[model samples]
Target: MDFEQGSINISDDVLKEIAFRSFIEVLAPDEKDVKKLKKSIEIERTPDDNVIVYVRTVAPYGQSLVEFGKKIMKNISENIQRMTELQVSAVNVTITDVVEKIETTEEEE
Candidate 1:
C-alpha cells in the first residue's frame, strides 16, 4: 500500500492579511480620525524563509520601539499558526518613515 500527501504552501493573501492585522494591532488607531493613517505597510518573504515587514506610521510616534518589535513577533506567530504548514524562521520590521500627526481642531475634537 502507498500513501499520498501534499505539502502546504503559504498564499499571498495570507501574507497580506497578516501584515495588515499586525499593523492595525500595533497602531490601535481611532475610528473617527479624519486623515488616513498608516501610509504604507508591506510584507515580503525572502528565499530563505525569512519574513520582512516595513511600516510607516504617523508621528509623533506614540508606541515605544520595544513594543513595536514585540507586536511584530506576536503577529507573525499568530499568522504562522493560522497557515499551519508555513514555518517562518524570522521576522524583520523596518520603519521607513514617520508622518506628522494631524492636529485636531475644536470642532473635530
Candidate 2:
C-alpha cells in the first residue's frame, strides 16, 4: 500500500509573522505589552525539512519567565502546525527582557 501526503509550502517571513503574533497572544495583557512589545523567531530547517523555532520575547516584570516561555512556545508551535501543516521539531522560547508595566492612570491621559 502507498500513501501520499501533499506538501504545503510556507515562506519564512510568514512563519516569522505567525510566530510573533502567537508569541504576543501569550504575553501578559497589560496594554503596554500589547502596545510596545515585539518578538522574533528563527526557524532552523532540519534534514527532513521540519523546523525548530527559536523565539525571543519580553515578559512582564515579576512574571515567571519559565512559565511565560512555555506558554509562548506551546501556543506558537500549535498555531504554526495547525495553520501551515508544517512539522515543528521544537519551539524554544527565550525571554530577552522583563519590563515593568506602569499602571495606566487617568491623570496621565
TM-score of each model, in listed order: 0.54, 0.71
RMSD over all Cα atoms, model 1? 6.8
Please report the TM-score between candidate 1 and the true structure: 0.54
Deviation in Å, model 2, residue 105 alpha carbon: 22
Query: Can you tell me which runs of candidate 2 are displaced by over 4 Å?
Result: 1-7, 28-39, 102-109
Root mean square deviation (Cα) for candidate 2: 6.5
Give the number of the best model, judged by TM-score.
Answer: 2
Candidate 2 per-residue lDDT, tens place, 1-109, comes to 1237664567777887787688767764566644334435677878877778886665677878788778888998998889887788999876666668523233222
Worst 10 residues of 2 by lDDT: 100-109
Candidate 2 local lDDT, residue 15: 81
- Candidate 2 lands at a TM-score of 0.71
Among the numbered candidates, top lDDT falls to 2
Which residue pairs show backbone clashes in model 2?
none
Return the lDDT, model 2, position 8.
Answer: 52
